[model samples]
Target: MKARIFVTLKGGVLDPQGRAIHHALEGLGFGGVNDVRAGKLIELDLADGTSDEDIDAMCRKLLANTVIENYRIEKAA
Candidate 1:
Protein backbone atom coordinates (compact mmCIF):
# COMPACT_ATOMS: atom_id res chain seq x y z
CA MET A 1 0.00 0.00 0.00
CA LYS A 2 1.00 3.56 -0.62
CA ALA A 3 0.35 6.33 1.80
CA ARG A 4 1.01 10.05 2.09
CA ILE A 5 1.42 12.18 5.17
CA PHE A 6 0.88 15.90 5.27
CA VAL A 7 2.50 17.68 8.17
CA THR A 8 1.80 21.29 8.95
CA LEU A 9 2.21 23.71 11.81
CA LYS A 10 -0.71 24.22 14.12
CA GLY A 11 -2.35 27.59 14.34
CA GLY A 12 -0.72 30.38 16.40
CA VAL A 13 2.77 29.08 15.73
CA LEU A 14 5.42 31.40 14.29
CA ASP A 15 6.47 30.54 10.74
CA PRO A 16 9.50 32.50 9.67
CA GLN A 17 10.00 30.54 6.48
CA GLY A 18 6.41 31.14 5.46
CA ARG A 19 6.84 34.82 6.07
CA ALA A 20 9.93 34.92 3.90
CA ILE A 21 8.10 33.20 1.09
CA HIS A 22 5.20 35.62 1.37
CA HIS A 23 7.57 38.57 1.20
CA ALA A 24 9.31 37.13 -1.83
CA LEU A 25 6.00 36.67 -3.56
CA GLU A 26 5.10 40.31 -3.01
CA GLY A 27 8.49 41.39 -4.30
CA LEU A 28 7.83 39.43 -7.47
CA GLY A 29 4.63 41.49 -8.05
CA PHE A 30 2.25 38.81 -6.86
CA GLY A 31 -0.32 40.70 -4.93
CA GLY A 32 -3.34 39.68 -2.82
CA VAL A 33 -1.48 36.94 -1.01
CA ASN A 34 -2.53 37.50 2.60
CA ASP A 35 -0.40 34.81 4.20
CA VAL A 36 1.68 31.73 3.59
CA ARG A 37 2.12 28.52 5.53
CA ALA A 38 4.68 25.88 4.79
CA GLY A 39 4.36 22.18 5.35
CA LYS A 40 5.90 18.84 4.43
CA LEU A 41 4.68 15.83 2.47
CA ILE A 42 5.89 12.32 3.16
CA GLU A 43 5.11 9.36 0.92
CA LEU A 44 5.26 5.83 2.20
CA ASP A 45 5.18 2.44 0.55
CA LEU A 46 3.98 -0.15 3.00
CA ALA A 47 3.27 -3.80 2.89
CA ASP A 48 -0.19 -4.76 1.83
CA GLY A 49 -2.83 -4.78 4.57
CA THR A 50 -1.15 -2.10 6.66
CA SER A 51 -3.81 -0.98 9.10
CA ASP A 52 -4.95 2.59 9.67
CA GLU A 53 -4.18 2.27 13.33
CA ASP A 54 -0.58 1.39 12.50
CA ILE A 55 -0.33 4.36 10.15
CA ASP A 56 -1.69 6.67 12.79
CA ALA A 57 0.85 5.30 15.20
CA MET A 58 3.60 6.03 12.75
CA CYS A 59 2.52 9.64 12.57
CA ARG A 60 2.35 9.93 16.34
CA LYS A 61 5.65 8.21 16.93
CA LEU A 62 7.93 9.93 14.44
CA LEU A 63 6.32 11.34 11.31
CA ALA A 64 5.01 14.44 13.01
CA ASN A 65 5.78 16.60 16.02
CA THR A 66 2.57 16.41 18.00
CA VAL A 67 3.48 19.49 20.02
CA ILE A 68 3.78 21.89 17.08
CA GLU A 69 2.51 20.12 14.03
CA ASN A 70 -0.53 18.13 12.89
CA TYR A 71 -0.58 15.36 10.33
CA ARG A 72 -3.11 13.76 8.00
CA ILE A 73 -2.72 10.44 6.28
CA GLU A 74 -4.10 9.42 2.87
CA LYS A 75 -4.09 6.08 1.27
CA ALA A 76 -3.27 5.85 -2.42
CA ALA A 77 -5.18 3.73 -4.88
Candidate 2:
Protein backbone atom coordinates (compact mmCIF):
# COMPACT_ATOMS: atom_id res chain seq x y z
CA MET A 1 0.00 0.00 0.00
CA LYS A 2 1.07 3.54 -0.62
CA ALA A 3 0.33 6.40 1.74
CA ARG A 4 0.76 10.11 1.17
CA ILE A 5 1.02 12.68 3.89
CA PHE A 6 0.55 16.40 3.52
CA VAL A 7 2.01 18.55 6.27
CA THR A 8 1.41 22.26 6.52
CA LEU A 9 1.90 25.06 8.98
CA LYS A 10 -0.98 25.92 11.24
CA GLY A 11 -2.78 29.19 10.99
CA GLY A 12 -1.14 32.12 12.82
CA VAL A 13 2.27 30.55 12.41
CA LEU A 14 5.00 32.58 10.72
CA ASP A 15 6.26 31.18 7.44
CA PRO A 16 9.31 33.05 6.27
CA GLN A 17 10.07 30.62 3.45
CA GLY A 18 6.58 30.92 2.08
CA ARG A 19 6.77 34.64 2.32
CA ALA A 20 10.02 34.69 0.39
CA ILE A 21 8.50 32.57 -2.33
CA HIS A 22 5.52 34.85 -2.55
CA HIS A 23 7.75 37.86 -2.91
CA ALA A 24 9.77 36.17 -5.61
CA LEU A 25 6.62 35.33 -7.49
CA GLU A 26 5.46 38.95 -7.37
CA GLY A 27 8.88 40.08 -8.54
CA LEU A 28 8.52 37.75 -11.52
CA GLY A 29 5.26 39.53 -12.41
CA PHE A 30 2.97 36.81 -11.14
CA GLY A 31 0.18 38.85 -9.69
CA GLY A 32 -3.21 37.92 -8.17
CA VAL A 33 -1.54 35.88 -5.47
CA ASN A 34 -2.86 37.26 -2.24
CA ASP A 35 -1.06 34.85 0.06
CA VAL A 36 1.00 31.70 -0.08
CA ARG A 37 1.44 28.77 2.31
CA ALA A 38 4.07 26.12 2.02
CA GLY A 39 3.78 22.46 2.94
CA LYS A 40 5.45 19.09 2.54
CA LEU A 41 4.31 15.92 0.81
CA ILE A 42 5.60 12.58 2.08
CA GLU A 43 4.95 9.37 0.19
CA LEU A 44 5.32 6.03 1.92
CA ASP A 45 5.19 2.45 0.71
CA LEU A 46 3.84 0.14 3.37
CA ALA A 47 2.98 -3.47 3.74
CA ASP A 48 -0.58 -4.51 3.01
CA GLY A 49 -3.23 -4.25 5.70
CA THR A 50 -1.64 -1.30 7.46
CA SER A 51 -4.48 0.24 9.43
CA ASP A 52 -5.44 3.89 9.33
CA GLU A 53 -4.69 4.08 13.04
CA ASP A 54 -1.07 3.19 12.37
CA ILE A 55 -0.76 5.82 9.69
CA ASP A 56 -2.33 8.41 11.91
CA ALA A 57 0.10 7.47 14.64
CA MET A 58 2.99 7.96 12.25
CA CYS A 59 1.83 11.49 11.52
CA ARG A 60 1.34 12.36 15.16
CA LYS A 61 4.60 10.90 16.29
CA LEU A 62 7.12 12.04 13.71
CA LEU A 63 5.72 13.12 10.36
CA ALA A 64 4.22 16.35 11.64
CA ASN A 65 4.82 18.81 14.43
CA THR A 66 1.35 18.96 15.98
CA VAL A 67 2.03 22.18 17.82
CA ILE A 68 2.75 24.15 14.66
CA GLU A 69 1.59 21.96 11.81
CA ASN A 70 -1.29 19.77 10.65
CA TYR A 71 -1.21 16.68 8.51
CA ARG A 72 -3.59 14.79 6.26
CA ILE A 73 -3.26 11.20 5.18
CA GLU A 74 -4.31 9.85 1.81
CA LYS A 75 -4.20 6.32 0.55
CA ALA A 76 -2.78 6.22 -2.95
CA ALA A 77 -3.77 3.82 -5.62
Candidate 3:
Protein backbone atom coordinates (compact mmCIF):
# COMPACT_ATOMS: atom_id res chain seq x y z
CA MET A 1 0.00 0.00 0.00
CA LYS A 2 1.06 3.53 -0.72
CA ALA A 3 0.30 6.45 1.56
CA ARG A 4 0.88 10.05 0.52
CA ILE A 5 1.01 12.74 3.16
CA PHE A 6 0.90 16.45 2.60
CA VAL A 7 1.94 18.78 5.39
CA THR A 8 1.27 22.51 5.28
CA LEU A 9 1.55 25.51 7.54
CA LYS A 10 -1.49 26.46 9.55
CA GLY A 11 -3.47 29.62 8.79
CA GLY A 12 -1.80 31.85 11.36
CA VAL A 13 1.77 30.70 10.78
CA LEU A 14 4.18 33.03 8.99
CA ASP A 15 6.01 31.44 6.06
CA PRO A 16 9.00 33.57 5.16
CA GLN A 17 10.12 31.30 2.33
CA GLY A 18 6.69 31.41 0.79
CA ARG A 19 6.64 35.18 1.13
CA ALA A 20 9.98 35.46 -0.66
CA ILE A 21 8.68 33.37 -3.53
CA HIS A 22 5.57 35.49 -3.66
CA HIS A 23 7.66 38.62 -3.85
CA ALA A 24 9.76 37.16 -6.65
CA LEU A 25 6.63 36.23 -8.54
CA GLU A 26 5.38 39.81 -8.22
CA GLY A 27 8.71 41.07 -9.51
CA LEU A 28 8.23 38.82 -12.50
CA GLY A 29 4.96 40.65 -13.23
CA PHE A 30 2.55 38.05 -11.90
CA GLY A 31 -0.36 39.69 -10.10
CA GLY A 32 -3.28 38.88 -7.85
CA VAL A 33 -1.43 36.59 -5.45
CA ASN A 34 -2.77 37.38 -2.01
CA ASP A 35 -0.58 35.02 -0.02
CA VAL A 36 1.65 31.99 -0.15
CA ARG A 37 2.24 28.94 2.05
CA ALA A 38 4.93 26.27 1.96
CA GLY A 39 4.43 22.55 2.54
CA LYS A 40 5.97 19.08 2.40
CA LEU A 41 4.96 15.88 0.69
CA ILE A 42 5.81 12.46 2.18
CA GLU A 43 5.26 9.17 0.43
CA LEU A 44 5.23 5.86 2.32
CA ASP A 45 5.20 2.37 1.01
CA LEU A 46 3.65 0.01 3.53
CA ALA A 47 2.48 -3.53 3.80
CA ASP A 48 -0.97 -4.08 2.36
CA GLY A 49 -2.48 -4.61 5.78
CA THR A 50 -1.57 -1.24 7.19
CA SER A 51 -4.62 0.35 8.76
CA ASP A 52 -5.90 3.90 8.68
CA GLU A 53 -5.24 4.21 12.40
CA ASP A 54 -1.57 3.31 11.89
CA ILE A 55 -1.19 5.83 9.11
CA ASP A 56 -2.77 8.54 11.19
CA ALA A 57 -0.41 7.70 14.04
CA MET A 58 2.57 7.94 11.69
CA CYS A 59 1.51 11.39 10.61
CA ARG A 60 1.08 12.53 14.16
CA LYS A 61 4.38 11.09 15.29
CA LEU A 62 6.78 11.98 12.47
CA LEU A 63 5.22 13.08 9.18
CA ALA A 64 3.84 16.31 10.59
CA ASN A 65 4.58 18.81 13.30
CA THR A 66 1.20 19.61 14.84
CA VAL A 67 2.48 22.76 16.51
CA ILE A 68 3.12 24.34 13.10
CA GLU A 69 1.25 22.42 10.43
CA ASN A 70 -1.63 20.21 9.42
CA TYR A 71 -1.47 17.00 7.45
CA ARG A 72 -3.68 15.11 5.04
CA ILE A 73 -3.23 11.50 4.00
CA GLU A 74 -4.29 9.70 0.87
CA LYS A 75 -4.16 6.03 -0.05
CA ALA A 76 -2.95 5.44 -3.58
CA ALA A 77 -2.95 2.55 -6.00
Candidate 4:
Protein backbone atom coordinates (compact mmCIF):
# COMPACT_ATOMS: atom_id res chain seq x y z
CA MET A 1 0.00 0.00 0.00
CA LYS A 2 1.06 3.56 -0.62
CA ALA A 3 0.05 6.54 1.44
CA ARG A 4 0.73 10.24 1.22
CA ILE A 5 0.69 12.65 4.12
CA PHE A 6 0.28 16.35 3.77
CA VAL A 7 1.50 18.34 6.74
CA THR A 8 0.94 22.05 7.12
CA LEU A 9 1.07 24.66 9.79
CA LYS A 10 -2.14 25.65 11.51
CA GLY A 11 -3.67 29.05 11.04
CA GLY A 12 -2.13 31.79 13.19
CA VAL A 13 1.18 29.98 13.32
CA LEU A 14 4.32 31.86 12.28
CA ASP A 15 5.89 30.63 9.06
CA PRO A 16 9.26 32.23 8.42
CA GLN A 17 10.04 30.03 5.44
CA GLY A 18 6.76 30.95 3.81
CA ARG A 19 7.43 34.61 4.43
CA ALA A 20 10.81 34.34 2.81
CA ILE A 21 9.35 32.65 -0.23
CA HIS A 22 6.72 35.35 -0.57
CA HIS A 23 9.36 38.05 -0.41
CA ALA A 24 11.42 36.30 -3.05
CA LEU A 25 8.41 36.03 -5.32
CA GLU A 26 7.75 39.75 -5.03
CA GLY A 27 11.38 40.49 -5.76
CA LEU A 28 11.11 38.44 -8.91
CA GLY A 29 8.31 40.81 -10.04
CA PHE A 30 5.49 38.33 -9.51
CA GLY A 31 2.67 40.49 -8.30
CA GLY A 32 -0.65 39.95 -6.53
CA VAL A 33 0.55 37.20 -4.22
CA ASN A 34 -1.08 37.98 -0.91
CA ASP A 35 0.51 35.27 1.14
CA VAL A 36 2.52 32.08 1.01
CA ARG A 37 2.43 28.97 3.12
CA ALA A 38 4.79 26.04 3.11
CA GLY A 39 4.00 22.41 3.74
CA LYS A 40 5.42 18.91 3.55
CA LEU A 41 4.40 15.92 1.45
CA ILE A 42 5.42 12.55 2.80
CA GLU A 43 4.98 9.37 0.82
CA LEU A 44 5.02 6.03 2.54
CA ASP A 45 5.14 2.48 1.33
CA LEU A 46 3.46 0.01 3.62
CA ALA A 47 2.55 -3.62 3.68
CA ASP A 48 -0.68 -4.51 1.90
CA GLY A 49 -2.42 -5.30 5.15
CA THR A 50 -1.58 -1.99 6.86
CA SER A 51 -4.66 -0.58 8.54
CA ASP A 52 -5.95 2.96 8.55
CA GLU A 53 -5.75 3.09 12.31
CA ASP A 54 -2.03 2.39 12.20
CA ILE A 55 -1.48 5.05 9.58
CA ASP A 56 -3.37 7.58 11.67
CA ALA A 57 -1.26 6.61 14.62
CA MET A 58 1.88 7.18 12.56
CA CYS A 59 0.77 10.72 11.76
CA ARG A 60 -0.22 11.54 15.29
CA LYS A 61 2.92 10.11 16.78
CA LEU A 62 5.64 11.19 14.35
CA LEU A 63 4.55 12.42 10.95
CA ALA A 64 2.95 15.58 12.28
CA ASN A 65 3.23 17.87 15.27
CA THR A 66 -0.43 17.95 16.24
CA VAL A 67 -0.11 21.08 18.39
CA ILE A 68 0.87 23.43 15.57
CA GLU A 69 0.37 21.35 12.45
CA ASN A 70 -2.37 19.40 10.73
CA TYR A 71 -2.00 16.35 8.52
CA ARG A 72 -4.17 14.63 5.97
CA ILE A 73 -3.63 11.12 4.68
CA GLU A 74 -4.48 9.79 1.22
CA LYS A 75 -4.13 6.20 0.21
CA ALA A 76 -3.12 5.43 -3.35
CA ALA A 77 -5.34 3.14 -5.38
TM-score for each predicted model, relative to the true structure? 0.97, 0.97, 0.93, 0.97
| lDDT by residue (tens digit), candidate 3, 1-75 | 899999999999999989999999999999999988889999999999999999999999988999999999989
Per-residue lDDT tens digits of candidate 4, residues 10-42? 999999999999999999999999999999999
For lDDT, the strongest prediction is 4
Where model 4 places Cα greater than 4 Å from the true spot, the runs are none
lDDT of each: 0.97, 0.97, 0.93, 0.98
Candidate 3 clash pair list: none
| Model 2, span 1-77: residue lDDT tens | 99999999999999998999999999999999999999999999999999999999999999999999999999986
After the best TM-score superposition of candidate 4, give how far the Cα of residue 14 lies from its true spot, in angstroms: 0.6
Identify the superior model by lDDT, candidate 1 or candidate 4.
Answer: 4
Candidate 1's displacement at residue 12, Å, is 0.4
- The TM-score that candidate 1 achieves is 0.97
